[model samples]
Target: MTPPLAVDIDGTLTRQDKSIDPRVFDVLRAWADEAPVIIATGKAFPYPVGLCEFLGIPLRAIAENGGVVYVEEAGEVVYNGDPDAAWAVAEAFEQEGYDLGWGPADMVNRWRETEVAVSLDRPGDRLRELAAREGQEVVDTGYAYHVKSPSVNKGTGLVSAADGLGLDPEEFVAVGDSENDAEVFTVAGESFAVANADEHARAAADHVLDASFADGFLAVAESFGIATQ
Candidate 1:
């Protein structure tokens, strides 16, 4: 049987500009035929849902770095993080004269529900301190600094999502490229880190591919006899 997948977006399927590698679309669709292909990312809600639509996959997503999990086929939406706690951290950042740093519009986090995303340009150490003061934790996703509850993470989200899908979380294979992806490495039956993965993620993974980005995803799929590298 083909294995299910929990995959990260940015730095895994996307380029530096954040555009997805088109080659992955066909590959993911093929994988979806046999098992679920979950788009798990630090990106806000609509993104993963929208990508699911575009990818023509009913399996769906784990968005906001595991703060939100949408199992479209199961029609279940799970919220693992505390939105109030995230808001408190965001408020604390503003009080300390540190904006979310996404400019006036801040579209990066506009649709976010359970976590506050801060730009990498801000002082991470200071942000961590502020989040800690609010009884929250700050996680660096390699894309941004996310202030959220310490309890909720990709691993927990995967467990919830898997239950909704009527599958064992340990049966899934995970692929990612950063610090935020580390927890998922533990829950998955196997984990692969792209060559471009963060140091933390690399250490957490069972396999580290020589290829980077979408190519690395193909490598993982290929190793499973599912797709071409």
Candidate 2:
């Protein structure tokens, strides 16, 4: 069997407005019918799981930038790091008046299981400094800054999920459009970055698409000879 396709959710699968393109959804649904389609994203577990529910697809998801994995067959989420450690770091930042919140806009400071996401406006350098001091890891997802453990990331989470499913890492393709996705690009045998991807992400990818968002994802699927119908 072809290895599953792991894709980032926000900028790669949806538009800036957080809306899924109908055409893209159509292709995704069709693709899911033939092979596993894993949702790899920086969002919390529920967010991507919610998307899968909305699409009526029984696909697994990697959330919190690899901090959590939701295995569809298991119907449970597996956490990669210590949630208390992440919260401790968040608390320390909060005491410093950092105004830490979950994500951007309405989702700001949303609660997560294994990681904490703060609005991107916060100083990235400070966050990194603090994380280093606490022996933690920080990654910018373009939408938010996530604090997690060094052991976990999109790459590790993707590998964990694929291994659990008995899929070969080299058979999978990863697609994304942000700095946090750089690690994912490194782990997958084939990686693609959308036109809107950050320079770092593009550099890490095996292919860079001219189109943005879902269009770019569709282009990637076509290039891999994956049927969109």
Candidate 1 lDDT score relative to the true structure: 0.89
| Local accuracy of candidate 2 as per-residue lDDT tens digits, 1-229 | 4447889988898886868766677667776777788899988788888888887888589988888887677666678887787788887887888777533453644547888887778877888887887778888777888888988889998888887677866677899999888888999889999999999899999989999988898888787666755
Determine which window of 10 residues in candidate 1 has minimal summed lDDT: 220-229
Off by over 4 Å in 2: 1-3, 74-76, 101-109, 225-229
Clashing pairs in 2: 101-109, 102-108, 102-109, 102-110
* Candidate 1 residue pairs in backbone clash: none
Compared with the true structure, model 2 gives a TM-score of 0.90
Rate residue 37 of model 2 by lDDT.
81
lDDT (10s digit) by residue, model 1, range 105-132? 9998899999999999999998898788
Clashes of each: 0, 4
